[model samples]
Target: MGVSKLDILYRRLLLTKLFIRGWGRPEDLKRLFEFRKMIGNRERCQNLVSSDYPVHIDKIEEQSDCKILDGHFVSPMAHYVPDIMPIESVIARFQFIVPKEWNSK
Candidate 1:
């Protein structure tokens, strides 16, 4: 089977000359981190910082110049909300009180 997209995205870029050299290119690094964050993959962000770069994960403070990508950026409210029925129909059926003053038309 082919490697999954998630697998590729989370692949370790550390010790790679290309990645180390491109560390200064925030334009490139930003998107990778952003996508990872969007998908709530904290590991990817941590890997980028601790593995992709020359510095160790523990040396975050020492490498003040490097922008630290934290996985906590992922929203805690990130969860699936399934829609079982049309929102408008649900609102019309379940609305307890309809204001007389409000235009029903």
Candidate 2:
């Protein structure tokens, strides 16, 4: 994840952090909340829609880009940070294991 700070994706990631923690300008927050709710609902229904469609599943391990990061956060601070420091910003990244293929250029 060697993304530069000036990159647009990096900015979007910062915006995502703000949106998730319910902090931002009113108009931006409104739009973010709207889209967040829409996407959240769509993700929530994915399992139901998949069951209905009953599409064939692929053996993803055979794919050329199939790399899974198997890991979990030990101490996620985002949940409790807001309560202590209302104005402070928080960005967290955890170490995870990814296939060598993915790490290779």
- Highest lDDT: which candidate? 2
lDDT of candidate model 1 versus the reference:
0.39
**Which lDDT value does model 2 have at 22?**
69
Q: In candidate 1, what are the lDDT values of residues 1-105, reduced to their tens digit?
A: 355777666455532566658543444454545554544666544543333323223212223333332221212112121232234433221112223354566
Q: Extract clashing residue pairs from model 1.
A: none
Candidate 1 worst ten-residue window by lDDT: 72-81
Best by TM-score: 2
- Tens-place lDDT per residue, model 2, 1-105, is 333566656457656756557665545545544444544676553543333432233222333554433323312223422323233334322334345464556
Q: In candidate 2, which residue ranges exceed 4 Å CA deviation?
A: 1-23, 43-92, 97-105
In model 1, how many backbone clashes occur? 0
Give residue 49's lDDT in candidate 1 (0 to 100). 37
Q: TM-scores across all candidates?
A: 0.19, 0.23
Q: Kindly give the stretch of ten consecutive residues in candidate 2 with the minimal lDDT sum.
A: 74-83
Give the CA lDDT, 0 to 100, for residue 67 in model 1: 39
